[model samples]
Target: MKLTEARQQFISNWGAFGTHWGINRTMAQIHALLMISPDALSQDDIMAELNISRGNANMNIRELINWGLVERVIVAGERKEFFSAEKDIWKVVRQIVKERKKRELEPMLQLLDKLENTEGDKKDKHMKAFLDTVGSIKKLSKQADKTLDTMIKAEESWFVGNLLKLFK
Candidate 1:
């Protein structure tokens, strides 16, 4: 593929993948652009390159900064902000995994606590069934939380094999 086409494809795929992962798509696209760019980009450059409004660019860039996936660069004599993507793929993956766990698991664990202690209506089969379902969900969610904890602690490649060993 031509260079421009490849860049566009990367941006599009990154944006879509970001949306699926609960991130703003435009932010991901901006990261994608930075990843493939030969040089760091100013905010105005990104806005023009991506055709995004200034506020949209700023917001998503801030989100990326929070996630540690992107960083600001300073060019001599330029007051506008410039950005770059983290070049280390594993670092990016780790940040994503850590962030996702924080977003998905903590609330789920809280819900599990609520579900486990709820008083079920033993007199009603329907209520019993509902509680049973909740129990199963709690169990599974707890297991997931444990798995994520292991993932967060283990050396990067060790996790997959260890998880597979525990799968039964």
Candidate 2:
């Protein structure tokens, strides 16, 4: 259909997908809007376009900024701060993966480390089972952490090519 309709659909779908990534819908929509926009947008512009309140727009924009997906930009002769998304899709994915690993995987791995250090006797079957389970999870988490770190550092061409090779 129209470009406007396509943009709207993309923003809506991106907002929905954000929830799966531990972000709120509005934050993702704001990110989507900035991503597709030709230039930076002010908070007012974001609110009007997203049909959200000023507070909602402000908060989500701030959150998106914290996520490293958006940044504050200054427009010539404009007092209102404008925001823009990281237009490079590879950088966006890397930042998202970095943040997620820091927030989720790292903490889980820390807890697993403590768990594997249980004070109970290993002769107990339940204790043995607990340690074994924790050890397995720790192993997988460490592997994932390494993999994500590599992805964050990898160039897009090499990364995508390597992924394609894995499926071949």
Which numbered prediction scores highest in lDDT against the true structure? 2
Model 1, 64-97: lDDT tens digits are 9998889999988988878899876666777777
What are the runs in model 1 whose C-alpha is more than 4 Å off? 160-168
* TM-score between model 1 and native: 0.83
Work out the TM-score per prediction: 0.83, 0.98
List lDDT for all candidates, in order: 0.84, 0.94
Per-residue alpha-carbon lDDT of model 2 for 18-131, expressed as tens digits? 999989999999999999999999999999999999999989998888888999998999999999998898999999999999999999999999898889899999999999
State the local distance difference test value for candidate 2.
0.94
Best by the TM-score measure: 2
What are the candidates' C-alpha RMSDs? Answer: 2.8, 0.7
lDDT of 1: 0.84
